[model samples]
Target: MNRFNIVYYTDPLCCWSWAFESTLRQLREYLKDDCEIRYCMGGMLASWNTYQDTLLMVTRPAQMGPVWMQVRQVTGAKLNERIWHFDPPASSYPACIAVKCMGRQSKNAEEEYLYRLRKAVMLEEKNIAKPEVLLQLAEALDKEAPGLFDLPLFKQQLTDETTINAFKADLNERKERNISRFPSLWISTQEDERKSLLITGNRPFEALQTLIHQF
Candidate 1:
């Protein structure tokens, strides 16, 4: 059995990425031990002050509501678009940095923290850009899993230069790979180190399953 690696490039506040959660969960269960999934934060939105997405026509925060609604209608993912109107996030960089901090604890912690961030902004209408909100989520995770996470260490890492550098590395990786969209994947098999496939945007479970089989 050949093992595979999947580099998942995504942002915490991306609507399409949130919609693809179910598909990702199914793919994970189906693959089991055959694949290793690594996350790379794409820094989708650094700050609205200098942000202008011509494709999505999302120059402002309020324009994002219809985009989320469209994704919900198409993917049937439960999303609250009111966040854009109510407490919109100014940038996704803070949440992305928080995820890098969580990764210092463990891979599981990193993944769970990312999911919590997505759920907070997408479904719960919480502002993930705030450090206090991010810390509260970490505390909740600590309560849920007890000693799986070190609260003091996690808090320190949030502002540490090392964690911020790690996130900057992810941003640079995305740029080098020319990945301009969320929910992008770079898949490669152990048999060939130089060859890989890049799939962007949200894809169905069967499409991913078939792609894995081809490898």
Candidate 2:
């Protein structure tokens, strides 16, 4: 049996995840052979009420116009700042369910849809909280999200309170550990079952290459 699992906990709406994209992506490509990695959703927003608090949420992207330029320059990704005003604050719940929908409906397809969802929220600045936006994004994948909306599996899986609770519990557990921020990976190998080392956040290929060599 696989004794240890690598928990890659992240929020789809997190800015740091956007910055760390290039690096974490490299890790996935390079380390797939040596270790088992699974993608898990960290629900960043549970309700719309929570969004009213953050300065980033209530204001238009024009409020922090520099963030748009900075993120693009750093990550080489594009974002549509107008999404903040045109749509609502990105809730990530709909996108989360969209990912769950993909996971339930198709196996490999989930990852692709998840990446798209992340790009929509992080780079494109789309309101992922809205089902309509999520449905539209899913449409690009040739997925009929509107149909899935009524499906018992999607309704149950996507709207499951237990799933959110579980995600919160996992987040709490990780927080208690106080390891580091999102986009951080922990590797546990059979040879070393004692303690795990924290990988630096959003680094180059050399960082992951070095960590893999540690095993």
Candidate 3:
């Protein structure tokens, strides 16, 4: 059997990605040691000032509530749309950069932090763009898993040029690959890099399993 690699392109603030979390967990359990998954941050929203969604006509924060409601209705994911009305995040770049900072510590840290970030924004109604909130989440994670991250190092890397550049590379990769949606996956067997598949949008576990098997 050939091992596989999946490069998941997602944004921390993306509701669709949050909805797909359960399926992602199931996929990991099914693949186990046979697959290696890497996360690539897609800067979904740099700032509201420059944001525009012609398809949804979402030019302001309040308009995002309906989008989240639609995602919840379709995917059955727990989400609080009130955040968009009350405390919407101005940008997703901070959380994305924070995940990259966590990656400097360990892959586990990066994955765990990303999960927490999604949960915070989608379910907990937390504004993840704030530095204080990001640090608080990191502290909570540290309490849960001892030595998972170096507090000082993680904090330092939050504003480090290298970490920012790493996230920029991910954005560049997404642009180069023409990936405009969250939860986009690029999967390929270790033996043949040229032969690969790209899956986009939220999908059911059975659908994903069948697709991976066919690939």
Candidate 4:
């Protein structure tokens, strides 16, 4: 079978990306052995310090309520809105870096870590910005995941020179592409990587399915 490669650009803390999880699962099942989904962590929120300057602290979480409501209506994915106030993340960078670190182990580990990170933020409402939380999540997952992710190495890599550089590189790629949205999909065949399709924002599963075929 011909291999289909897709670069999925998303953030772990993105509400819309959380909603798109079901669509991604469906795609995995649909594509089976024919596709490779490569994850590109788009650092959506660099820090709360950035948000504090523009929006002030109080109004930030308030703004997300309606947006998450819309996500619920469209994607039928549940979110704990209290997370915005209960234990909000300062930055999505930590989670993104963690995912990239897991990728060093294997794609399977990377994919599992991505989902676990997403769940921690969206459903469990944990503060994934904290290193302890990320490590805890990784520890819990290591028992069940196919390969044992080296905890000490993962911790070191989180802030290592190479890991930070990779994060910067991906962030730069997103900026160059001018992708201002989460849950974006860039689809192409291995034979012609340049000939691709870009799907931005949240769309229904049927829409994604159609694009998968069209691509």
C-alpha RMSD of each candidate structure in angstroms: 0.9, 4.8, 1.0, 2.8
* Model 2 residue 120 lDDT score: 82
lDDT of candidate 2 over 97-200, digit per residue (tens)? 56655665654566667777778876676777777777677666655444433344544566577555645565566667564455666667655656566664
- lDDT rank, highest first? 3, 1, 4, 2
Model 2 gets an lDDT of 0.61
Ranked candidates, highest TM-score first? 1, 3, 4, 2
Candidate 1 per-residue C-alpha lDDT over 14-83 given as tens digits, one digit per residue, 9 for 90 to 100: 9899999988999889878988999999999999999988998989999999999999999899999998
The lDDT for every candidate, in the order shown, is 0.92, 0.61, 0.93, 0.81
Q: Estimate each model's TM-score.
A: 0.97, 0.71, 0.97, 0.90
Among all windows of 10 consecutive residues in model 3, the one with the lowest summed lDDT is 206-215
- Judge candidate 4 against the unseen true structure and give its global Cα lDDT, from 0 to 1: 0.81
Across 12-93, the per-residue lDDT of candidate 3 in tens digits comes to 9999999999899999999999999999999999999999989788999999999999998988889999999889999999
- Model 4 regions lying over 4 Å from their true place: 51-59
Model 2 clash number:
1
Give, for candidate 4, the lowest lDDT window spanning 10 residues: 51-60
Q: Tens digits of per-residue lDDT for model 4 on 29-127?
A: 888878888888899888655653233223365556566776788678998777776666778898888888888877888888888888887788788
TM-score of 4: 0.90
lDDT of 2 at 130: 79
